[model samples]
Target: MSSETTAASMSTTTASQNPADPVLAGLKTQEAHPVSKKLRYADIGINLSDPVFRGNYHGKQSHEDDFTHVLRRALEAGCEKLMVTGSDLKQSTYAVQIAKDHPGLCYATVGVHPCSAKQFDSYRGGPSALLSAIGELAKRSKASGHTVAFGEIGLDYDRLFLTPKDQQLKYFEAQLDLAVEIQLPLFLHSRAASEDFERLVSARLPQLPKKGLVHSFTGSVEEMKRIVEMGLDVGVNGCSMKTEENIEVVRQIPLDRLQIETDGPWCEMRPSHASAKFLKDAPPLPKAVKKERFSPGFMVKGRNESATIPHVAYAIAKIKDISVEEVCEATWNNSIKMFGLGEVSK
Candidate 1:
């Protein structure tokens, strides 16, 4: 079915169930603002393969899978293209399959997350074999246009409890080599490991024509400038705008070098965040209900979805004092240029 048809159908279904439902309210708000109709967005990082989308939270299923509904809402909200992050071998494989299943509407990235770096040692054929397998997946998937970048790979010093610093460094470098060899743009992550992250990525920057993105960036202005100096793009999400410093860093980021993502199932925009105040004029989001009371067209509370990506753009525009349309257009082009996702009609 067409996206408009799907959105209309969902809206009708929700309106019939409850006149005061948040989904219907949101749809009405969207019509009034018409931001979704006037703009387009490309969420460069979304954990679509995360089990949360399947209603599995903290290892228990609270409701039926609403992945399809999630996509519909995203499209309806003007987030027309989404990149599914692949943080491990298995998730990478699933991400590629999801891109194939959804075609142009979705794309995939393949890499082992630094936190999961230890998995490299335990793979059936060991670290080298694991690296080779990821290489193969990227090649095959890229050939078919299902995969766009190599990532979810980088350093996370704050989470050393998950994977030791040594392991994260070793595998991150290994994956960097794989990304260089695969010749795809990168989708990266970094947490309190700026020094090492910059050194490693800068060393390999010459070999990567498409460069890459440092996603969920919440670093200091110096760190942001250094990443931009390395010729890498920066991706912002809710986490990137949580604090006053984060807002300032985002405000100073060169618009041409910025991309946006939802980082769904995590990094949601909370009411207490510094960005919340800027969102006063932003688009209204669909109402969220608790998981136990989950309805087909409503968001599950606390679980972020790509549908909320417009809010990210609005916040950025507000922080930077630019028009929301400019933020949306620039990010849409920046993401497509960096990842080569091809043309997406507005």
Candidate 2:
């Protein structure tokens, strides 16, 4: 695929499938939600529906207000720091830009996403090129008031078109080496390749100098244990929160290993069972509705959601069956630990 296509794919995030207007109209005719779902926290994940909602939110609309705009929202939502992850050169560069624009409160990740590798021709041009590109990004990440991690670079069995598995592993291992060289933490993303994923890490575990996280995780209890053992953190996001294992894994994790994310402009979260009132049951404006898809009034919200972080805090508390304060503090600490945002953690 052309770089144009890759860039476009990265940019455009829309609803899954346009529904027929009549279907939506009919659903709306019978629309009467049994209960309202309220959002408690921001469970970050990757998505493609809202452009206005995309990017490292700094709070305002302009890029200049990055820190004040994006960081402020996260801060107000109780997010002390936000790590902006990247997929490939462009997005990674954008991420670094966001971090530089926002400074202290905003951080970044540098690496090629599994999905974007094909544009680079499975890095056929060579790994050296990627390394050099990453090195430049890493330098920018090290600039004043920056918090950086190497991430969104891992194996994804879910995306078959992106790369052959062997090539993906080669590139992933290379990024891991970069993470080791930089002595920075990592932000990992894995999908479907669970069976061999750990062994790949195990081979590298002995040589790796630093730890990292598997963002948007959905692994077995055994997998979770292996990750922790390797000195990595878990990016507890809303995407996997709906399943028994997602929340269940959290229950067993030590508080320090639990980090939270909204993967904003992307992944969606679930609503609190109690706060259904604020949630609209319809989809976007009817005119906004492309097809007759059944547009529910509302979906889940996150920490820095349509409301405040307390909702996410509440959601976390409920999922973990712990006090909101505990989840808040632990996640705060975990994020701090993962991104090297030390002083602000307390």
Candidate 3:
């Protein structure tokens, strides 16, 4: 696989840390990736609360200013709303704060990431205590009109080093139960544990909220079908288009059941995936988009940003032989339906 495709893998690491990652190195010098202008979209999952995206860059020291910069860029590119994801308690708190501060521009998810599930066992009062705390945060976020879902939570056997399977299950079920109890939609993750993931989700399907999403999905066609059959939406991003096989998987997903996201600073689409030759009727790159950096280190030339979601629409349109408008409209409506974005204003 190309370095760009590999760099799109979901992780908390920056491209600079991985010397071999060309995508990161290219960001410093590469031309900005093309994006469609006036494409109103919503990112189902983005970690705006992550420090790396907020840290000092371009002589800026204030994280709030850094966030505003990113959000403004996204607004200029047509990102209507951003769901800031929280994988653990600390990050969840940050997510809620960002959403609360921004109002309609941002929303927060409350739950522990599967990889960080070990924190439940290690913390005082164990899993129950963590759930209670997350519940409280969810309450506050909801009261502030910010919290939209319960997640970044699910099974991740692929990262066994981060949390054992047993502990992951314990935490996953607890959060699933909590989500159902609170009557909130879910923002879930699953990797290398499809069987258990399906089983667990199937077992809880009835109690869970009426709508939910499988964020950053990179699963088999069979798994995708199962998820759709269970009445859940599937999220697609740069990672979802890593290989031709992955592209084929995305092509099969019903547009209505699919939602698009940048999962920014990660999951960037490979250049080859959305080259000028393939982008039919795509508009010229915006001057500000080209001038902006996706993060403190990665320029718009390389790193993924919520603003670049149009590229995701472009790539999917190419693979599915559909128009970018169709992809954008369907995903936009799916996000609104699944997250009930309309209710936030009330």
Best by TM-score: 1
Q: Native-vs-model 1 lDDT?
A: 0.86
Per-residue CA lDDT of model 1 for 1-346, tens digit only, reads 2334223332322322344654433432355237678888899999988878877777787898787788768878887788999999888877886777566678999999999999988899889999999999999998998899999999999999999999999999999988898899889999999999999999999999979999999999999999999999999999999999999999999999999999998999999999999999887898899999999989999999998998999999999999999998899888888887857424
In candidate 1, which residue pairs clash?
none
lDDT of 2 by residue, 1-346 (tens): 2345334433311111222322222221232222112221232222212223332234333211111233323333344455667778766766665555444444667778776655554455676876778767776676544535676778898887768787787778777777777766677888888666666666666655456778877777778887888777787655546565566676676667877776654444545423222224222211122112312222223312321334445555665567666776677666654465534444
RMSD of each: 6.4, 11.1, 9.7
Error of 1 at 183 (Å): 0.3
Q: What's the lDDT for candidate 3? A: 0.74
Ranking by TM-score: 1, 3, 2
Assess candidate 2 and give its lDDT: 0.54
Give the TM-score of each candidate.
0.90, 0.69, 0.81
Put down candidate 3 lDDT per residue, 183-278, tens digits, no spaces.
Answer: 788899999898888888788878865568999988888989999998899999988887667777888999889998888778876656523334
In model 2, which range of ten residues has the least summed lDDT? 282-291
